[model samples]
Target: MEEISILLLFDVLVGLTLVWLAWQTLSSLDLFRAIVLFIAFGLLMALAWVRLNAPDVALAEATIGAGLTGALFLSALAQLSASTKRKDEENKIENS
Candidate 1:
């Protein structure tokens, strides 16, 4: 009974965390923040899979869904930031 209650509490927290992370990922104005939230969402999803006794699925999610995707997002963000900086410099040069 105690074990069941603890599992139930863990389940509820995981659900809430998934919802919150999804909402934050959708609603964030900052691109970097949204990517971070998305990565967190993926990790929470992996945890949910682990709770369901699917370690293989959880491993896939952790590696492919979160790790690789987060790395991709970060890579894109760097390129975007660099381009934006270049554009801003061009604008400044034009104004001067």
Candidate 2:
């Protein structure tokens, strides 16, 4: 009974953290900060899955949800930054 109560408390805490992370990710003006927060949320979700005894879900979340998805987001962000830089350079060249 005591263990179950503790588990319940932990579950609630995890859920709250997840909610907070989601809110921060959505509301933040900085895209990079939002992406980092989202990645942290994914890792927390994996931990929650492990705690719930779902090893398969934990594994999938860690690899696919967190790892691959975060990589893809970061890559896209990099591409956007690069494109912006290229446009700036082109503008400077035209002006000169």
Candidate 3:
């Protein structure tokens, strides 16, 4: 009975944390911060899947969901920043 209660508590905590992380990721003002939070959420989701006895799903979530997707987002963000910087420099040159 005690072991079951402890497992229940763990499950509840995991569920609540997942929801909170999702909210934080969506509501974050900074794009980088949001992306980082999304990665964290994905990792936690993988853990949750593992707890639920879904190792294949957990592996997919950790690798493709968090790893690949996060890398792509960061790469896109870097490209956008570089493009904006180039545009700003061009604008400055035009103004001068």
Report the C-alpha displacement of residue 79, candidate 3, in angstroms: 0.6
Model 3 worst lDDT window (10 residues): 7-16
Candidate 3 regions off by >4 Å? Answer: none
How would you encode candidate 1's per-residue C-alpha lDDT over 1-96 as one tens digit per residue? 999999999999999989999999999999999999999999999999999999999999999999999999999999999999999999999999
Alpha-carbon local distance difference test for all models: 0.96, 0.94, 0.97
Task: Give every collision pair in model 1.
Answer: none
Measured against the true structure, the TM-scores of the candidates, in listed sequence, are: 0.93, 0.87, 0.94
Alpha-carbon shift of residue 31 in model 1 (angstroms): 1.3
Candidate 1 ranges beyond 4 A from true positions: none
Displacement of residue 52 (Cα, Å) in model 3 is 1.4
Cα RMSDs, all models = 1.0, 1.6, 1.0
Sort order, lDDT high to low = 3, 1, 2
> For model 2, how does the per-residue alpha-carbon lDDT over 1-96 read when each residue is reduced to its tens digit?
999999899999999999999999999999899889989999999999998899999999989988899999999999999999999999999999
Of the two candidates 1 and 2, the one with more favorable lDDT, higher being better, is 1
